[model samples]
Target: MASSQEFVQYAADQSSGAGRITYRKMFGEYGMYCDGKIFALVCDDQFFIKITNAGKRLAPGLTETPPYEGAKPYFLIEDLDDRDFLTEFITATCSELPMPKPRNKRKSNDTVPKRRHQNDF
Candidate 1:
């Protein structure tokens, strides 16, 4: 089942301490990003944070579960009421995740051949 927008927004608002929290449609679910790095996801109304060493250290009793089918387990965050803890935990986790890869740049002329000047050769 698809997650509700209200739930996604609540997740973003709760993690605002991480800085510039945003959510996007990702593979029929929602991807929570901060500073261009995806740190968590909202699937089926459940919030799941990426399993990072920092996260594991912060919450040792985290319930590990996959956000979707055929995916690795993430730290299932059940307590969203505590905004401070969520922000702190998510900030630490985001620090461990790598930034998004730069997109490939292609020159426009590469696709269409350049026209030769009519000057005498």
Candidate 2:
């Protein structure tokens, strides 16, 4: 799996427009987020955008497969060597996504009660 930093850099280079693109490690792979919604994923050094109704219509030939075992549908950019097609796919996927919401700042430990399973009732 590629490092999150490496994945983000690659996504940044592939992306266009003024919109910000971010990446985070997810399910042992890299997930690309535009605004806040996940638009794409990187696995085995390949990019695959989330399947959208619009994208399905635009690129009907694209394959919808899980990036890994027991994963959701993702549109794999079969021709990774084709930069033009990759860019177009990314742009279309990002356009359909809404801006991401800010993540909560609370710490995991802070939210957990000190007592273990106190409310058994």
Candidate 3:
């Protein structure tokens, strides 16, 4: 099931203190980012933050669960009511995650070469 828009908006708002909170729809779910680095995911209306040593230390005792199939376990944050905790936790989590690498841009003239067949000779 896809995550609800309300849930996604709420999650983003809750973590807004972390700075530049945004989200993108992915495979029927949502990947949440803070300052361009993904830190969490909202899947099926559940909140899951990437598990890092810093995050683990900050949110001790949080359950571990995969946000989606075939994925590593993340910190399952059940308590979303506390804005203060959410902001602090998200901030620490973003700090733990490395910034996204720049993507190589393709030139307008870039194109695949035509395959030459034996008949062409």
Q: Which is the leading candidate under lDDT?
A: 1
Task: Report the lDDT tens digits of candidate 3 across residue range 2-115.
Answer: 889999999888889889999999989999999999999899999999998888888789999988889999999898889999888888888878999999988565576778
The residue pairs that clash in candidate 1, if any, are none
C-alpha lDDT of all candidate models, in order: 0.91, 0.72, 0.90
Predicted model with the maximum TM-score: 3
**lDDT (tens digit, per residue) of candidate 2 on 2-121:** 545664576556654424677778867787776666788888777778887778877998888887778798987756556576667667777777767778987889788877686764
Cα lDDT, model 1, residue 60 = 92
lDDT of 1 by residue, 1-121 (tens): 9999999998888899888998899888999999889989899999999999999899999999999999999999999999989988988998999999999998687799777788834
| Superposed Cα deviation of residue 105, candidate 3 (Å) | 0.8
| lDDT value for model 2 | 0.72
Clashes of each: 0, 2, 0
